[model samples]
Target: MFRHAFRRFPLRVFGLVALAFVMANILGGLIGTALAATIGLAVFLPLFLFKILMVLMFFRFLMSFVGGYGPRRPCSRGRIKDRLQEPPAEPTKEETEWREHVRLARKELDELFPDAEQFIE
Candidate 1:
């Protein structure tokens, strides 16, 4: 449903809000790289990634309380489904049977009372 609306956050739509966990943590790498260059701690790659990870952890923890409003509201799923995918136009089994029965009964009545139409004048 929400697959196309938010293509970037597709995984998050399926109720698994923790998929791209490292997304917010990538900053740790940036911090580590900055520190390495400034202080000659030059271990940029590994340590920077780790710093980004810790930052991600902290941010994720904070964001856990903040589930933003998605493209579709929770209450709107049922209503949208109901409106979009309606039943086919063909008659129901019971309705078809009832209509057939009425046709037959009218035919019988016409045959039994053919003269009834003439007396109407």
Candidate 2:
């Protein structure tokens, strides 16, 4: 289903995001508390906001990458798999005959024309 569509690339990305989220939340809390005690609320507030943004972004990115669980199927209107799998059309018999005729005509012209030196004008 989604397993074939997504592959392992997105799963690896989700794992990395989750790791970053954990690290940021833990470190940001510790660092934010210390900075507030020393530098005050003005600087600490921005740092806190930045940490919150990072957490939210990481979760959003992770969820978007996660694969769906279900049977594999295309849209209701048409089968995407069939559309992708279809082979290109081969030339029709008429087209093939036309190409062959053109080749024979070119050969005949070359024989008749021979060389420019052989021609009078």
RMSD of each: 30.1, 29.2
Q: Which ten residues in a row are the worst by lDDT in model 1? A: 66-75
Query: Per-residue lDDT of 1-121 in model 2, one digit per residue for the tens?
Result: 7877579878889899999999999999999998877788777789999999999888766655444222332343246667767897899999999999999998898888878446756
Q: Give the TM-score of candidate 1.
A: 0.26
Each prediction's whole-model lDDT (CA): 0.72, 0.78
Tens-digit per-residue lDDT, 7-117, candidate 1: 857655644544444644567778887877877655566798899999988876666555432334433557667867987789989999999999999899999998888
Estimated TM-score for each candidate: 0.26, 0.25
Most lDDT-accurate candidate:
2
- Candidate 2 lDDT for residue 69: 20
